[model samples]
Target chain A: MFGNIDRHTYITLSCVILEPNSPKISLARAGHMPFLVKQHGGVSVVTPRGLGIGLASAKIFDANLEEFSLELSVGDSCFLFTDGLSELQNPQSQDFGYEPMLDVLRSPASLSAQSIISEVMKSADSHAQGHPQHDDMTALAFIFKGTNKILSEYDSIPL
Target chain B: MNDVKFTIDHQSFGDVKLLKLQGYLDAHTAPHLESALGDLIQDGNHKIVVNFKELDYISSAGLGVFMVYIEDVRMTGGDIKLSEMKPKVFTVFDLLGFPMLFEIVEHDQIALSKFTA
Candidate 1:
């Protein structure tokens, strides 16, 4: 439908469906950045092949689209972000890039999902060096606490 | 003003049209690119090549412009071959699986050669 109405404008969608009370979460990406999985202090960028919406006919788009699944161990954190965050630039016109963004995901385990977002935003702001953002910036993050730990306001906070 | 400077330099090699893009391509500048591609398709010129050697930056919106025309051109026995994309520009395309859908060449001659060979 998008190819008919306005072919030039498109949307990137990243959907994570969590099975009830399970560490196994399924991810579907459509022309968006990959999701980050930080488990055991190692960062993995989970990129399932996907083309953005309105880029091709439904047949071709669906053919190329793929879904990925992974089981999260204790303290596994997953992060989703828009292209705006990684593409954020500083005064020198150099993009903040993925290396530093991944660095934020590698943060200590003491920090909750909330703090991860805060740390990334803070890092991006510092990298911007007073330059205004050029794109819509949005970030969402969540950590699997293994269904045993007491859920605090910080751990369960919806940001 | 949210505007960023973007320019397209056009050249014709036999049946193929080469468009050299320069400067930033964000939401503000995507329409200009869409119209340019639309005009080319309208003129019955589908064998196209886009040189990203000079393009400094591309946003998600800019990336969508290629999607708008790929199917239309491909159905008509032609294709849009992208060439000479800087590492940064190529990285953005790779992020969204564009390389699988489009032919990305390392040089303009390679892209142009694919049209005839």
Candidate 2:
């Protein structure tokens, strides 16, 4: 059905399905940027194989599409983003690049997904140096707190 | 206003069509590359090669152009092979996991040989 549409219209997308309290994650990619998975004291990029929508027929899409399953351990974090974040440029016309983004992920301060997102956005803004973003910047982070300790701590917070 | 210009030069090698892209490939310039691929597919020329040696940058929009036509070309018993990419340009494609979905060769001749093979 996608192939029948005009070629000029195309989009990249990524989807992740997770059930509450489940460690198994199902990830689907559609020509989107590779996501990062930080766990076990290391960061790895998950580049799942898939094609973009409206790019081909259902037959081709189904043949090439692959779903990835990941079992997250306690304290594992996953980061998803668009090209806009990595391609952000500074006054010197240099892109923010993946190294810095990875650095942020590797930081010890990245105790939670929210913290990681905040640090990355702050870094991007600083790198931009007042240059307006050329592309839409978006990112999503998921931190797996498998144990009840973290959940109970959240319950202790004042409402 | 950024003065970023993208150009695509088409060259034919037997059944293979080569598109040499230069300059940045963002949302603003993705349509140019998309149209080029569309024309090639329309002409019944499915075997294609895109040279990224001179391409300075490629955004998701630019990458989407490849996804747009790869399956159609493959269905027609043809393929869009990439070649001669600079490391910078290649990194973007690599980051997006294109190397898994597309045939990316180090040299143009290698890509050409694959078409003939």
Name the best candidate (by TM-score): 1
Candidate 2 residues lying further than 4 Å off, grouped into runs, are: A147-159, B1-4, B9-17, B30-48, B64-80, B94-102, B115-117
C-alpha RMSD of each candidate structure in angstroms? 2.9, 4.1
lDDT tens readout by residue for model 2, A1-159: 475666556667898887665777788898788878887778888777886666556677678788988887888778888888988899898988777778888899987776788799999999999998888899888777884322313333357
Give the CAPRI class of candidate 1: medium
lDDT agreement with native, every candidate: 0.83, 0.80
DockQ (CA atoms), all models: 0.64, 0.38
Output the number of the lDDT-best candidate: 1
- What is candidate 1's lDDT per residue for B1-117, written digit by digit as tens? 333489888999999999999888888888888899899999999999999998998887798788778888999999999999999899889877788789999999999989989
For model 2, residues B1-117, the per-residue Cα lDDT tens digits are 333588888898998989988898888898888888898899899999999989888876677778777777889899999999888888777655567678899888999999998
Worst 10 residues of 1 chain B by lDDT: B1-10
Q: What is the TM-score of each candidate against the true structure?
A: 0.87, 0.77
